[model samples]
Target chain A: MSALALFQVVSLFLMAVGFYGIAFRRSFVGMLICVELLLNGAGLGIVAAGQLTEANPVLAQLSTLLVMGLAAAEACLVLAIIIVVAKRWKSVDPSVVSELKG
Target chain B: MQTSALVLFVIHALIIGVGGIMAVASRSLVRALVGLIMTLFGVSGMYLLLNAPFIALMQLLIYVGAVVILIFFAIMLTKAPAGGEEERPNQVRTYLLALMAGVLPTFVIGWVVLTDQPASINAPLETGLKALGQGLMEPYFLAFELISVVLLVAMSAAVILAFKRRQSR
Candidate 1:
């Protein structure tokens, strides 16, 4: 396989790992960590495609930057919510904090 | 690929893989954060290998510096537990289910990628801070400005949410 393909495989594997973590982790913070991993994997795939494919180089860079912005915003908002949930429930376990379940 | 480039790729991949494992599997929250930082660093190095130095720098600065710190602070302030629960007795069944759920789509994607080789773009990245700046301002100005606004909104929302929650208690 070419180097680019190898990198693509690595990023895909990372995404899979992140998915596993999201499902397996018992705590909200751990799931948050997995979410970051998934985001990074997406960024990596974009960077690789930009570097390897015939598409505009700036396009990938721009999209990756946008993804970074999204990630930052997501992190801030989710962490805040996590804090609120912890405050109300006195725990970070998603299973325990599900108060509004139908 | 040049021998040196190949070596660097191997190194970066190893770093990323190991760091990813530590981040996902570690029981301690702080240790998981450390692993995530290592993974981000490796990703930046991959960006360097891709000839996007600016992206690499931004990745290091934004992800490693800002995001990591934010998560760390959240964990610290919340005093979240260090270790999560141990794998339950039905761990194998759950693992199989999760594996099946995660791997199916990935297999389809991998098949498509293997079958359809994307057209390769061999143009060297125009490597100049000025050019990138101009590109961002000229064609992507709307996105640039919008991201700033989005960030501001996110900051305000976080502050309001946290503050309101604290007050309500």
Candidate 2:
């Protein structure tokens, strides 16, 4: 495999692992961790594409920067939600924290 | 790719792959967090390989330094069970479903990447911090400004959510 393809594959691996974690892990925090992996995968793929392709490199890095910022913002909000959920529901499991379950 | 570079790339890829699996599959949340740190570190190495050192450093600072610490705080605050007592006898179906869901996308994307190879352009190596800064300041100024606004809003929202929870109790 070419270097670029290898990097892309690794990023895909990260994304797959993240999806599995999100679907299978019961804890909200674990899902959040997995989300991080997914975002990292996205950023890596973007950079790899820019690096190897004819795409504008600066724009690629810029996009990755935005992704990082968004990840940070998302992490902040999710962590806060987890705290609030823990306080109110007394459990961090998604099933236990459900109030709209029919 | 040179022989040395290929070796380095393989090492970093292994780190990311192993760390990703560990982060997802570990029983303990703390161990999962550790695995996530490893993955972040490996990604930064990838950024270095891709000739984006500034992004690599930022990845180290923002992801490994800040986000991981934030997660650690959350883990400490929640103090959930150390991955025990939540198992059910009928969870095999759910596990298989999740595995399929994850693997399907990987295979589809992998096939596309392998078959549709992007033509590599021998562009000048100007992916330095200076270029990044100029791009952010010039053409991407609106986006740069908007990102700060987004971050500010997110920070305030997080603070409000936490404080409101405290006041409710």
Give the per-residue lDDT of model 1 (tens digit) for B1-169. 6788879989999999999999877878888889999899999998898899999999998899889998998779778654544233336876787677568767888778767777554433655777678879999999999999999999999999998835552
Cα TM-score of candidate 1: 0.92
Quality class of the docking in candidate 2, CAPRI style: medium
The residue-by-residue lDDT of candidate 1 on A1-102, one tens digit each, is: 766687788788778878887887777778888899989999999988878877777878888999999999999998899888888888777778766898
Shift in Å, residue B37, candidate 1:
0.9
Interface RMSD of each: 1.9, 1.8
Q: Please name the candidate that would achieve the greatest DockQ relative to the true structure.
A: 2
Off by over 4 Å in 2: B84-90, B121-126, B165-169
All candidates: TM-score of chain A? 0.95, 0.96
Give the per-residue lDDT digits (tens) of candidate 2, residues A1-102: 666777888888898998888888888888899999999999999998988888899999999999999999999999999998889888888888766888
Give one digit per residue, the lDDT tens place, for model 2 in B1-169. 7788888888999998889988987788899999999999999998988888888999999999899999999889998666642343337898899999899988998888889887654332547678888999999999999999999999999999988835542
Model 2 local distance difference test score = 0.87
